[model samples]
Target: MSEPKSYIQVLSPELLGRVFDAYAHKPDEEKHLIGLETTLFSSCESGFYANPVILSHVSKNWRNISLDRPTLWSTMIMVRPIASHIPKVENWLERSKTAPLTLQIMQTIPDDDTPIEPLREERTAVNTILEMLLKHIERWEAITFFLCIGFLPAFAEFPQGKLDQLKSATLNLATWSTHPQVVDRVFRAIHAAPELEFVSWCASFFQTGLPDHVPWQQLKRIELDVNDISEEPSSVGYVLDILSKCPQLTSAKFILGFCKTTTPKALNTPLNLPNLRSLALDEASSPNIAYVLQNLTLPSLHTLNLSLFSDEERSSANLFKAVGSLVGRSKSTLKYLGLDIDDEQLLKLLPFAKDVEVLRVGGAKTKKFTSLLTRNANNKISLEVLPKLEYLHLTYAQDAMRPHRISASTAALNRMVVFRTSQPPATPGLKKLKFISVGTAASSFQTAHITLILGTYSHLNLKSVRFEGN
Candidate 1:
């Protein structure tokens, strides 16, 4: 034991810190950790540990090395900070030194379904931590809030216009009230941050116009998930007005639920976003989604995701047509398209997305998906549509209208694969395919079927084929 030694023990502090930094900030793991505050909070008090804490516990030398590295402690995730953890929070701040901080503050009531007001002692501890951080506001790189209605007043005590280093902010508000005035005040305070470039807001229930004093023109990214966005004419107008103001935006996402009406005044003038590159719309009504698309001219757009959630059979066709029209308008630049639509809508829009390199289609449509891959009455492959398509992802839902059609779709898909593979040089064909199905039955093509299909097209160099089912 006395003679035992490891190679890592010989590394310099700088080199060890670099290794620890990489281990602590694995990009994908950090992304997963960002929205998982509950898990982090629970683990904080558990014997299981991660990151700087674990590194410090390894040995005396390692502990000194970990403490000397500021990057390892710059991010502080405060999820329901308790009075007992004040000393720990203070120690973390002290160790962080002057490194730019990314703070995520989420206050959730522990072990209680009923909403009770925050205890005075808990408020005092939160204020103490916030007051300490406020002294170094210039080091704030990003701040996120997952606050309940009751904690909003406590958050309002921060001094104004102090975020010189701030670049991003996220607000996730969970409140039963229809009108959350605190949301407006929060945005007002955010507006005071001159360097803020990205903002994401998720309000469980929001019923108000855009807050005043937002630096809309300077923002490069925006995300909004609000209920009843298109319920009122005024709300729709405000949304459109905000979009019009943000000419520098390169990416945007929206989730508007239960849109029952339209705003004619908002749609009167089209919004031109020449710089936008990525747009994602989720659970939006046909009219509302089309209204937003019709008004935008996305010359730089390359990625588009339209996850439609409408039950109106007749209106869905119109929505699909509008989307097709929008794609036609963006044909010069569009390259990636993800759609959740039925086969009929897919057929209607396929021509517009001929140039799309990557395509993902799902939601009760895969049953009829093979029909699109088949040759019409003619004996030739339908390479005219999606000639540039390199990647295809198909998802099968168990409750498709015609589950019996699965076999037919599978047959058609096999034929399409064979015919496309057998084509002469200069003809582009499918390079990769991903099949994911959710059903009790064998909804996706079985391994044997795939092997048989590939055997017939052995000469074709298929890049990859993945099959997943549940």
Candidate 2:
């Protein structure tokens, strides 16, 4: 009745689910086999979620077992087949009796060209059910909490009066519409409660109604991610005005934005969040790049990832230059930096940071970026410039990967480790090389690497060459 097992592994697509069925239906003996951590089909995205919910349809036995794996059910957010998922998830909650659950919900923004906030047919139904569930679970003393929604602002309207029940929450509504109101309500609710500790709003919390300064001595971490700062004053900078007042705060997130001198400060005084341990700052527009770089001051900041992932070309180059110029200015507090600038940008930053130990840059994006600075000067992008540089990372593409040589003599370059897609560039001063994406296979990488290895370095007594995915 069954074909002989083939060379290729033919595990049943529903193998895990079927096993789960046996455990949930029969008790005791087999229960240990179907643990909560069983791998579900997550890669197919829609199908992954669908399979779990659909399993309930096959038999009542499945319905009961599926509930045991709360992780799988909670992982279900917004997706196709959610219409069918409604009843299944509702049933799971009904049986769960509000024991307290943390839901992760998100809306994928397919791409830039995709229309903003395109309404799906079931948007209202889904939101209505989720909100009702939030209220109902609280009523039943059921522990259900959080219907975390992402990319969808309408979801903000769901928990309306029931936010008091949530344990942890994240609100990242980027639009100005009613997002501020949602943030206002969420922040007020959290401020009043002792149970709720973790709260991150995609909208700026300090920028809104609680005043540019709140008596937030109790606050620990605060993040303000700005999507449109260059646009005519969306709430980004308004939030910063309020954030300046959150003194003694521990962690902070700032989205670079500017305010016109004429416009009143969203709050009267400058906001300072002291005792920050980690921080993330970004710039979508290039205009404020200079001011943002100059204004960035984190005394206790240990980890840093400065970025310029902008689509603006002309402003991008200038932004890159500004970011580069700010590097060495800080007193070497940064342990990590995720830079998305080009060669010209890196060269400008070299003189600034004397103690920067770790650096991660895009693959061959370095070449195009590197080419900018060398355009006028010698073709050298080297350690003489970055005297204290330690780890150097490159994001490589299918094309050949190489870096501009500043000086083949600096001891720092000699100590630097290179990670790339193409074979490592051989340099006399180069120390260690790690190839992240080598071409074809291990066999082919050898000859190409051999030729590249011999051709890359001078006879200045170089370090060893490594084949990565080996």
Candidate 3:
């Protein structure tokens, strides 16, 4: 025993906490220390062990000790054909002999139409579980049903319905035209939900006009890809109506639409909101169509994302006159702006070049689209050069390499929009260069960029670097 004289290092605070937890026989009062660790992965917002997977390793003894907890097994997430999830959920149900379980049904869309899980058996098995979940939907915290079948939910009933059952969810349908059930399910889900507070996405359609009584009052955000939004994008009136009603609404986006007329300055509404922070819209509108913007201002507005959805019906000359008259003013209040031009007609028509420090426009119709950019940017003149601008990003799908190089960036070729400085973005106020993103002829990543966009860093000391593109 006297030979046991050896060094004993002091345990760190982290180690001591772990040791205490390992020895503590926590009972039912511990909200987090549940017995079942076989199922469920939640966030801090989800209110439980943030990551349940770690509990499997609290020592070999815990491998099966925690698997018997039923409330712990009450929720399940089905992501793919990862066959393991089935057995795990099944085992938990069998062992715990549990109460009604909450199941999250999520299906991923294949990039191409190559039957997502080439393994037919996996697909079949997954579908079986999906049908089971739908049938066994007795008790639930909220429905997080991810739809991959073939339709978008059409909530015939607005905010209050039994079929629109959801607490928080994200549903996406890339092409809902061919699928009727997809839309039907989406509508049912929307109708069933009481207050949907999360993200919703629907793209590629001829039109999208939901029922008048949308669950918009509690919505924090809504993204509608108005199909066939010509110069007069459909649903703007409805969308704006929702905004005017929902004081909690903060973010809005419209992917494609036709502008039949210009937006009015008053938006033809008498309501007022002092908390609007993010707005992104672009399409055709009546020439006299205006928002109550001049009358009601977004004192908290942080981002504005607007783009021209379709330019086919627009006449070059008429568009010039129309764009020339279209304008927005709040004393340089917006932090970010994105614009798309079908032809050079847009640039020739609008006064946007000098308005915002961060600008992005697509010359979809012709390379000559940037001609206005070239003309405006000549003579060392930077009108829209944001004195507090930290980044200037641009991409020309139709245009090739730029005619002239921007001297602002040393790593210009490697970057999407290079910085005025070469050092890493250590200073919060300095411009940060990002990797260039270019899509090809086949896989066009147009709208996808919105989800991954690196917005303007709100820094007051930033400046716009001279930029030019072909």
- Please, what are the lDDT tens digits per residue for candidate 2 over residues 344-395? 5555654454445555553224333333212112234443333334454443
lDDT by residue for model 3 over 1-470, one digit each (tens)?
54653222255434543433333222212344222223333322222333333554665434444443444445565554445556655554454353545455455554565464443544554555554444344333445544454442232122224333444554444445576445555555564556566545444223444534356677777665555322244444545555666777667664435433444345443445555667666553322123322333455666755444344433333443432233233332655655454445444533443334455544452333323232222233322233343444554343232111122222222232323323233333333333222232222233433223323322322343222211
Q: What residue runs in model 1 are displaced by over 4 Å at the alpha carbon?
A: 1-19, 27-50, 59-65, 78-85, 109-112, 115-129, 152-154, 173-185, 204-208, 226-238, 263-269, 312-314, 319-321, 327-331, 373-381, 390-470
lDDT of 1 by residue, 123-144 (tens): 5666677777777778888887
Count of residue pairs whose backbone atoms collide, per candidate: 0, 26, 51
* Best prediction by lDDT: 1
For candidate 1, give the lDDT.
Answer: 0.63
Instruction: State which candidate, 2 or 3, has the greater lDDT.
Output: 3
Output the lDDT of residue 264, model 1: 56
Clashing pairs in 1: none
Query: Residue 328 CA error for candidate 1 (Å)?
Result: 4.1
C-alpha lDDT of all candidate models, in order: 0.63, 0.42, 0.43
Q: Work out the TM-score per prediction.
A: 0.73, 0.52, 0.51
Q: Between 1 and 3, whose lDDT is larger?
A: 1
